[model samples]
Target chain A: MTKFANILVPVDFGAPSRRGLELAVDLARRNGARLTLLHVFDVPVSYAGMGLSPTELLAPMWDAEQEELDRVLAKVRDEIPEVSRETARGVPWREILAFIEQRRPDLVVMGTHGRHGVPRALLGSVAEKIVRLSPCPVLTVRAEDEA
Target chain B: MKRILAAVDLTSTAHLIIRHAVELARSMGGRVRLLHSVVIAPQVPPPGVFVPLTSFRAHELADAARTAMESLEESIPRELRDGVVVEIGHAADCVCEAARAYDADVVVIGAHDYGLISRALGTTAARIVNRMDRPVFVVRPMPTSHVVEPEPVSAKAG
Candidate 1:
């Protein structure tokens, strides 16, 4: 049987993401795979158009996001000790794909909102995009419609 | 208990997909059902070709697909193979239908990262995840080197 050595879970601190984290923890513990919790901070490009330097304007936002991430990481660590955490700044899907390429985790466990119809077509999902482009397989856990 | 439905394309990654489903079923004290869909391409005769009327090719293809699915079922360890299903239609639709028909707890599938053209069109696994209400576990074939030998501890640590 192929055992997973590393499992990557991207967290957005949403309920769906929390469900994904829970599933990742279960799979990691079962396979003795190392878990890496990732959070991406996407800086809006519009800030660059403004007079303010994007980095300078986003400094406070980054700090707050990092603080929240740290809190989440601490909570997750309590459940799965020795789990690693990563934070990236860029487009959410692009950063995630880059991380997957660099780390080469056996599996990526993430959450999806499970949207459909016009709304989904209008606003594409990050989870869907990652599933489409990630270097490795992605197990998507939907927020609702659990069967 | 979990009832895993493994949807495979019978490609090189089919075995991996079944393996993952079997392992998960074993760990969860569940059962596994293997499903394969035969996508019947629209038989479009060439613009200037004289084609003889023949039996429905889709039926013939479905029969061949059923045989192949049965062979695949035989390849699986008897203990792990609970059921095998071969359906004819779009891969995504068939998988979703099987899941509903079998009351699958989760749907396991293999995904191939196709080129930009196919990516734009979307893959069956993606379609399954979008349509099925059940959880979908998509497995991509890992490089043999990575699976055969564990990475350095330091590499993972960092």
Candidate 2:
């Protein structure tokens, strides 16, 4: 029997990700695992060419982002009081993998939009990439199927 | 959660995958059904070669898969073992169908690090995740030892 002590959940705040958060909270309660909610901020490519230093442009955004994350955390804290929060800036998938490498969570619970075919090819999915590359187990919860 | 469908390939990681499912089931008061899918390749004979190869190979492969699945069923923990399902079809499709049939709350599977080709074409776990409506728990093979280290953070705000 494997016991998970640390669980990581990445949120984009979409419906699917919110569902993942719900599942993560349940799992954390069941396993007595520490839960960390991570939100990765991807810098737009347009910002790189805006002439202004990316850091200067992103400083205020980081403050707003942290505040938004805290707001989201407040909603769930009652269900999962001890849950931790993390914010990173980079490619979403790469930051997730790096976090997994750093924290070595026993399991990662995340959401997938369930995109398929050409769109999935063109816009690669972060959840798919993490599932492919994460060193730990990944449990993916998709939005409820309409069909 | 009454049932957990564990999709395995009879690989070395199969036992670990089953164990994970069983342990979760034990904790949650559910049972596990081990599922194995036998993928039958299309045997295309040359234009003039009317060889009866396709059916023969499919039969042989399906038989072998059944034997392996039966052995795997025997090895499941007595309390958690609900039943075993051996199906003939695409792995992802079979898993989803079995989940529907068994009314499984979750689908547990093992993923192999198939390197670049799998990365491009997608692995079984990826396909199942995309196709199945149920939650999918993909367990990667465990490392030989536990080693934890903090990774250098790569956040750049400038």
Candidate 3:
């Protein structure tokens, strides 16, 4: 049988990421696989310079992001049989690569991020980096252009 | 997800790519169209004010690719085999064009061992993703040493 037992989706609550999640949910349903929604968490730069306990300073942010993740997951809970959520704290691309290495999902479904002062569509961004470095299949879902 | 366009390079990974395509087609109740692009190398005239005729035999390459594609097709279940297409031009362009012509819902492509150039610019798969409106599945090209040859389609059901 074709085994897509685990599929990972990195969400940023963006339109493209939502497109990716929708595709992933459908894929998981067809393949009878589970989905993992991973979101990279970053502490605001304001709290970084101070040598305080970063955990305490970032708790609220973490909680807030967790809630956001929950909200995202709730939308697809009924569609996927075993969908899970996670939050990683680091650079988005690096954290995603680390998660893939640690969890070794069969596929990664993510959306392409838009222009960020760099070359248009070239990204130099998370989706591009993950597409270049990811060890498994990566299905990139780009949002349809508005007419 | 009914129509899957699989772009394959005629390397060892071609077999693995076909396996992925077949498996996906089986699962999603889809039909797969295998596409191979015969990348034509650009020709330059002789230097020192000498202009000469030049030609790149893309047709021969396409024929060879077709033979190879047929070999790979043997491994695919007959039902899932939609067809095979051989195009002459840039790989990414051919893939997108074929996808559009076939009206494929998703495109499956293999990511290969790219050099420093692809790292700086972009891989073919990435370019396709940037341009194509639909989903593109980029299968990681496993290192040759670590790769295990795919078995027959009949035995792959396990």
Candidate 4:
């Protein structure tokens, strides 16, 4: 069997994202692969003009974000013993691409809003960009369609 | 994980796309159904005009697609390919329809290198991922290291 050794799953605390996480866990467990749960957070670039330093604005949220990342990965800890958590600070897709380059995960499983979800708030089209640019394969899981 | 619907084009890169589906089925214990969507323009006549041969193009393309897919099967793993379907319609729409018909757990489609317009106008894989009711595994075309004979101009199937 061809091994998907390193799998990366990006979460944004969305309902669809939860589905992506669970599926990633299934793949990791089946392949005995290492899984990385990633959450990218950066204080808005627009916030810089408000006289608040990036460090000051990011300080409190950093712990909270890491906590969320930890919590997300914790759900799979029992199933995937080798899973790890990653939180990056930048634009979501850019940070993800950099992470992919740094650690070339064989597969990336992430939640996507598809076309209608692209214009949704927060991670707008992040999955779209990742799917287009990632050097490896991407498995995009959408929430169950209401149709 | 039990069933995968793999959508492929007539290009050589489809061999690589089918391999991805095979590996996934091997790793997760599933069977794969191969599908090819033939791209035929819809011939909608002006309301007052009676258009002859309206369905002709569709039938012709579907037949060509079936032949092309048969050639593709010879290059892919036969055992894992449990079923083959040749659909005539938009690639993205056909893929989602096939996924529903197959009751596939995931849809595996080949993604191409980005064109300038792809971001604005989504790729078929992107469209299916959004509108589809299931997970999608998208494989990008990679430049092969070794030189092989280029595939002949392929049937307009994806």
Candidate 5:
């Protein structure tokens, strides 16, 4: 039997990311795989100012974000309770690759909006970059495919 | 007799695909053939020199291909050994052609699940899926060894 250890999934609190998380949960449950839920914080410039005290500026965002994570975990626990979470503050792509490098998950499952036409062409795609760069195999689930 | 064909690239993904194919072949009482294809790029002349180009050794590539197939065969359960077959060629074309030649009911493959463009136009898996006559089961690269629970028979049904 092939064992999948350390399954890492990057989420953005969006519907597509949620779908990816759901699938990852199911796979982890079935395989007894250790699951890591990752959320990358792509901080805007306003947050970068040194003037604002950590609590004065970042408190609300942290509270809201943690609340969302709680909601997401709640849903997953409703179905399967075994899951772990991690949060990283950096670019989505770099942080994801760095996390993979540090932890070395067997698989990285991510969700793509699967945008088309102007949106897809102009923005390129994070999923595409991850596929080309990641050492471990990646599963890029389309938003609609999960439904 | 039902036949199963597994494509390998000598990557970890190959291990996943071969294992899945072996199980499927075992359940169906079918023979399994493991095929690998090496995409050899044509040699190009150096910028200023026009030297005679060296040809690639088809046999050499085929030998490496056989080795990859054997690697997969070694990982599979012993009962399925007699039915295993290995060959190498242009991955996309070889996979589709081998299936036709062997009359394979299904070809097991692994794809790095990406967007529609990536799925449809990027990888050899997409190209093989498009060209092959037989159904190609695309296995997600998630390793299943961690699942402590018994695999539901239905998990492998597809």
Candidate 6:
């Protein structure tokens, strides 16, 4: 039998990720699967010599990022009406995979830009990376195709 | 009508792609072909005096594929069953070759998230999409609850 007990959607507070979220929510609502909305707080980094205290430099960023995530979750709840949301701290890809392994989610819905070249190489696409390592099935909604 | 090919492998996710293709075919009114490629058994080494010779077999593997299709038969809505097609070969090549031979309009597949290694090596769906000349829809299997079972739009007359 087909099985999907939980669906994990990683959000970046962007249109692409938002689109993926909407799709996941509608799907979970229809299928009666619990939807977990996640936003990761990437660890802070500061240059060595031109230093400020770690907390002084990083605390504000963490607060601001958390605030933004809270707003995003609120907005998703308002629009979709049914889903669970939480925030976490770590590298996006690693955290996403950890959640998958811990939760053993049946599916992961992600969005991609289908990037190529130097910019893609530098930033490293999360969706692409997640697709590569996720043990479960991943649905990558392309931004260009959505339009 | 242009043929639409849905490639099925032994993976659990393959059914999701098949269902998606059936839905698309119902909407587009096209012929659908379901192809499952059974890999020919690998060659066995020659027998040593102390050991029995090994024989490679293909039929047993093909039977497994057929059984899987049969188990999933009822899950496929009735309207789409008439066009179901099943064959076996190495996953990537068979999917591409069948698409070509059938002159399919679109090819649908389901991809498991294989992580970093598969990305570098390219997953089967990615390989097929890149190497083949057809649009490939790689759907992530929706959680069973999320899988929308299309309600019949028209009611039967009494």
Question: Which number leads on lDDT?
Answer: 3
| Candidate 1 local lDDT, A19-124, one digit each (tens) | 8888889877777678999999988887877898766789999898889888888887877775988999889989998999899888899887765543334113
| lDDT on C-alpha atoms for all candidate structures | 0.75, 0.77, 0.79, 0.76, 0.64, 0.63
Off by over 4 Å in 4: A53-56, A114-123, A145-147, B42-54, B74-78, B114-122, B145-158
Which clashing pairs does model 4 show? A114-B130
Task: Compose the digit string of candidate 3's lDDT tens values, residues B5-88.
Answer: 899988876767777788778778998889999987766756766643322367878889999887777777777888889998
Q: Which runs in model 2 stand beyond 4 Å of their true positions?
A: A53-57, A116-124, A145-147, B45-64, B114-122, B146-158
Q: What TM-score does each of the candidates earn?
A: 0.81, 0.82, 0.84, 0.82, 0.54, 0.58
Q: i-RMS, every candidate?
A: 3.9, 5.1, 3.3, 4.9, 9.4, 7.4
TM-score, prediction 4:
0.82
Q: Is 2 or 5 the stronger prediction by TM-score? A: 2
- Candidate 6 CAPRI-style tier: incorrect
Off by over 4 Å in 5: A45-57, A115-124, A145-147, B1-7, B10-158
Listed per prediction, chain B TM-scores read 0.79, 0.79, 0.79, 0.76, 0.73, 0.69
Top TM-score prediction, candidate number: 3
Candidate 2, residue B77: Cα displacement in angstroms equals: 2.9
Model 6 C-alpha lDDT per residue in residues A6-119, reported as the tens digit of each score? 778998877777767776775566555677888887764543455677588778977887788777777767655567776778788889978887877766877555433332
Model 3, docking class: medium
Candidates 1 and 4 compared by DockQ, better number: 4
Which 10-residue window of candidate 6 chain B scores lowest in summed lDDT?
B149-158
Q: Tens-digit lDDT track for model 1 on B1-158?
A: 67899998878777677767766776566877889888766668989997654346667777887777777666555666678888878998999899999988778998774444444324567678877776788876555544543332223221
- Please give the range of 10 consecutive residues that has the lowest summed lDDT in model 2 chain B: B149-158
Model 2 agreement with the true structure over A20-113: per-residue lDDT tens digits: 8988888887776788999999887788877997678998887788888898888878777778999888999999989998998988998777
User: Where is model 4 chain B poorest over a 10-residue stretch in terms of lDDT?
Assistant: B149-158
Cα miss at B133, model 1 (Å)?
Answer: 2.0
Ranking the candidates on lDDT from highest down gives 3, 2, 4, 1, 5, 6
Residue by residue across B55-116, what tens digits does model 5's lDDT show? 34656766766766665576655655544444435678878787788787667777763333
